[model samples]
Target: MNDEILVPLDLSDAIAMIDRQKEQIAALTTENERLRKEIKEIKEKIKLTNEYVDKYHGLGDRSLEDARKVEREIALSQSETQWLNR
Candidate 1:
């Protein structure tokens, strides 16, 4: 009957183990919230950068400013008048 012995679990050891696991779970929850906020900020920054690129770098006529311009007067010369000649 010595080989077939029964034992009872100590309640204090089980309570200590549960308390440690609860602390670990609380730490993990706080770390998860921090990571979530960090990801949100990163996504917002990426969105702002994309908006800036689209506003300033997309399909704009930046080369037209380099073309040269000249000022000149246009005149029309008439050698004869139609009513006087007729």
Candidate 2:
């Protein structure tokens, strides 16, 4: 049989415990808000990065003639049906 006796808290102790828990909850709420803001900022940064990459991909020094020549070379290497399928 268990011999330990359980002790109950007085009113003051219970009130103190409640106040401590309230402070903890408030701190957690603030942290949650901060994390949400950080996630939004990260998402924005990712969007900007994707835009920069898309813009960078379009930057080219090739002339129209070079592009046509490359296309002709690719056409020669692969069958017309394969390109059509794509």
TM-score of each: 0.55, 0.54
In model 1, where do residues sit more than 4 Å from their true spots?
Answer: 1-9, 59-86
Candidate 2 regions exceeding 4 Å error are 1-9, 58-86
lDDT of each: 0.51, 0.62
Ten contiguous residues minimizing lDDT sum, candidate 2: 1-10
* lDDT score for residue 44 of model 2: 69
Q: State the lDDT of candidate 2 residue by residue for 1-86, as single tens digits.
A: 13222223455678889999999999999989976875675566557555655555555654444455555654564465346535
Candidate 1 residue-wise lDDT, 1-86, digit = tens: 54333222456667879999999999999989976875675566557555655555644564222211100110111112223324
In candidate 2 the C-alpha lDDT for residue 37 amounts to 72
Q: Of the candidates shown, which would achieve the greatest TM-score relative to the real structure?
A: 1
Error of 1 at 61 (Å): 13
